[model samples]
Target: MSSNSSIKCTVKKPVEVKISDTKSSLCSGLSIVDLSFPNNSEKGIQQIESISFKNAYTAFLTIKVKSEQNSSSTGGKWKMCLHRYQLMTSPHYESGSQDYFKIPSSQMLFVPQDVVSVRLILQQPSSAWNQFGIEQVSIETPTENTNEEEAISKWLQQHLNLNSTVKKKIENVEVDEVSGGLHRMWALTETVKAQQTSASLGRYEVDDSYEINLLSYT
Candidate 1:
């Protein structure tokens, strides 16, 4: 009997993907953010084992100490717990910062292939005046590279499943980078109709504008 040693996978270049359309409200108690990509045929959402934040900070939004409130007050006891998780992994809490904080790579844990989500849970203590806040937030993950032609082939096969000739024509189309990072790959010949339809259906249009993080892959 043969035993499988491991499942090896390579982390590729980061690609810009739309996670959310707008910024969320500042939630202090418990906030859950969805990190899945939009559902589309041409897109393959990256499976992340780790992530990092550009800036993460927790501080006192406002501190009001009442004369009546003593050292035993409950306000001084609440603290923020920064946690990240996937479906299979346990919540990894970040520590070591009562003020500005950034998670170092050494402290990061593995995120699963399942959708990644983050939560900021509020921990209350025995004293008073313990409100906390987080801001300047950014989320990131490493992505794998994709072959442009393979993407185009898959898109065309969606429509031309019966017409191999048309599929060949579409595949034969060549493009050159004419200006400012735009690849002139669209064909205006008889294949124009096919191109237009494929585009509207969310076919290929390269969007490589995103920050990349070159961390050691696990």
Candidate 2:
């Protein structure tokens, strides 16, 4: 896989997405933000993944982070962990509060303090919101205690199912460079974790065990 440091961050700043006033067809839109910001601020794109349900649409928010060796940064320790932020959709109020689509799990892992990315995926196959638009999206950096591996691990263990035949390994960590010297991000990979890979890299994960959560702020 290719690696690079980027300027991206999870936008803690929340924005509003207007909800439909009347009954609309099932449709989904996509939203994304810069995951790598402040530190190694680089703009990246967020792509859409399949939805969990046929009736429900799905979108994604993404940020880019490189290894410390990839870029330069002063943040230490909790540099690589999940960061938290809120996303507010609904230009108008949905019962006084803007409609919020929550990521089943909050806090994306490994996003640097300053640099993060966010993206949205629209799954309105019914074309109800072919022109869906989010009025505003806000983002900000999380605090020092954002890392919640124990909680996340517990959650994963409870939700994730382990397989006996899956071969997993913890690969060596590689540090890459950001677009500029603005900030640094951490990129980590494990055999247990599943993502797309090239034929040259071998094949996709054979096990269907654990899952991960990620998002970006606007």
Given candidate 1, what's the lDDT at residue 54? 26
Taking the tens digit of each residue's C-alpha lDDT, what string does model 2 give over 1-218?
22222223344432324446468632234333222336433432222111111112222233334334333454422232323222323323223122444222234443332222333322222233334333333343322343477668766665544532331221222334333332422233343345656545313323443223211221
lDDT of each: 0.33, 0.32
* TM-score for each candidate, following the candidate numbering: 0.25, 0.24
Q: Residues 1-218, candidate 1, lDDT per residue (tens digit)?
A: 21111122222222222235368533233322222233311222233323333212221111111111221364423222224322111122234223334342234433222222233322222122233334433333344445687678777678797888887887776654344234234444447776565433323223543323322231
Off by over 4 Å in 1: 1-45, 49-99, 104-109, 124-130, 144-218
Give me candidate 2's TM-score against the actual structure: 0.24
Model 2 spans > 4 angstroms off: 1-98, 101-117, 143-218
